[model samples]
Target: MSKTPKYFIVEAGALPEIFLKVAEAKRMLETGEVDTVHLATKRAGISRSAFYKYKDAVRPFNDMLQGRIVTFQILLKDEPGVLSSVLNIFARSGGNILTINQAIPANGCAAVTIGAETSGLEVSMEELLSRALSVEGVVRCEILAG
Candidate 1:
């Protein structure tokens, strides 16, 4: 018998490095020390391109009620922001990312495996499918739910 998948929620522009700084900036801003991106980036030693690359792609983790999770194996084109775009869908769909594994391209495409919890998805699986399919460089999206 197969199990269901868990999901998480993330921003559309968030990336790994940017995600860390954004979290830090949120805390710093709370202390009223810095409220601008310039200050935050300066303090964090992150470039603006890196910040903008993943500004909206960050998200908090979430686990499914059924305690199930899905592993999405994606084939992405070799280009900038392609991986981020793919992650954005999962983030926007409330896919709590547990881990992301990628490999070097073999045929102008890279394989990425993302483990996420599908606990509190705002949209249906069909919608998620549509979104993933709509990405610019996504060659394939294989959902491995078990």
Candidate 2:
């Protein structure tokens, strides 16, 4: 049986530069910045072989989750100011909050569901999630829907 592929959220700084180049080339092609993969790779400063090697494996987070209503399920520690700190992450990242529903604290944790419009995000979805996960009270944060 074929195992499902695993996914990871890696910081751009931690990734090889070639991956960024491939993403840039893909974006250039999609946006009409370049007419072909050859030109895209050339402009992005990566070899065509390098682009082809990683193209299918890398997609920009902004492209994957941009311009849509994204719903996030966040698990937070039941503590004062935890929710506010999480919401501030969204605000600072340009996520426009559309709705939020919080379940009562249970087992010293709270589950919060947030729906936000992501068209205006100043950072990538990956960056936004990383920031959320970095918060002191955030136990988990993930996209529930989009």
Candidate 3:
């Protein structure tokens, strides 16, 4: 009988060099940088056997997030255009806005939650969150769900 595969999110620095090279080979092929697996493996400095062994198992973090819906909860100062500024960040990042909820301001701050489709996003979730936090009047942001 075959065993089911289990996965873990290890930091890039901790991964074996061969695994990283395999992932790079895959990227090269996907991006049309190389026309064939042999070329990709050669460019990435990995043997064809190693590339084939790990290519299916390794993927970039953003590629994993593609096609998923992500929700974020944000705290913002109740100032003019703060919400607009937040939405603009998502738009600029290629996130497809799905829904937005905002509570009435209480004590000079408001809570907002945004849901966005990430399939077409130009940036990763971490980058999106960073951009949101950097917006003027944004107090804090966190992933509510995904």
Candidate 4:
């Protein structure tokens, strides 16, 4: 059986410089700033082999998730200020909240679905999710779609 692919959210400072260079090279090519991978790699100050090695695996967070609308489903303890705290987290993270649909509290919990535009977010989606999860009374949080 084939194993599922695993991914990690790492800070930019922790990654090798070559990965950033490869992402830049790919962007240059996509935006027509460079005509070929050869020139793009040279301009990015990386070797062709290095660029090829990481091109598929390394991507800027903005390139992957920015300008997209994402929906998050959250399970929260039904208590005063719980939803407010979650919304505050999203706002502080730079996500633009578009809409929210919350269900009535039942069995001491409530389900809420939030839609947000991510273009202006200062942090990666993973970080945003982590922050949301860290909020008090948040039982669970997940990206339903994007």
Residue-level error in angstroms, candidate 4, position 8: 14
lDDT of 2 by residue, 62-108 (tens): 67679999999999999999999999999999999999999999999
TM-score of each: 0.53, 0.70, 0.77, 0.65
In candidate 2, which residue ranges exceed 4 Å CA deviation?
Answer: 1-22, 28-37, 43-61
Q: Tell me the whole-model lDDT of each prediction, alpha carbons only.
A: 0.71, 0.92, 0.89, 0.91
Error of 3 at 84 (Å): 1.6
Point out where model 3 deviates above 4 Å: 103-111, 124-126, 139-144
- The candidate that achieves the highest TM-score relative to the unseen native structure: 3
Residue-level lDDT tens digits of model 1 in 24-143: 654455567888777876787777677667555543332122245778788999899999988888888877789999999988999988887776667755577679978999998876
Q: What does the lDDT come to for candidate 4?
A: 0.91
- What does the lDDT read for residue 110 in candidate 1? 93
For model 2, the run of ten residues with the poorest summed lDDT: 57-66
Q: Of the candidates shown, which would achieve the greatest lDDT relative to the real structure?
A: 2
Model 3 lDDT per residue over 4-43, tens place: 9987777789999988888888888998999999999899
lDDT of 3 at 77: 100
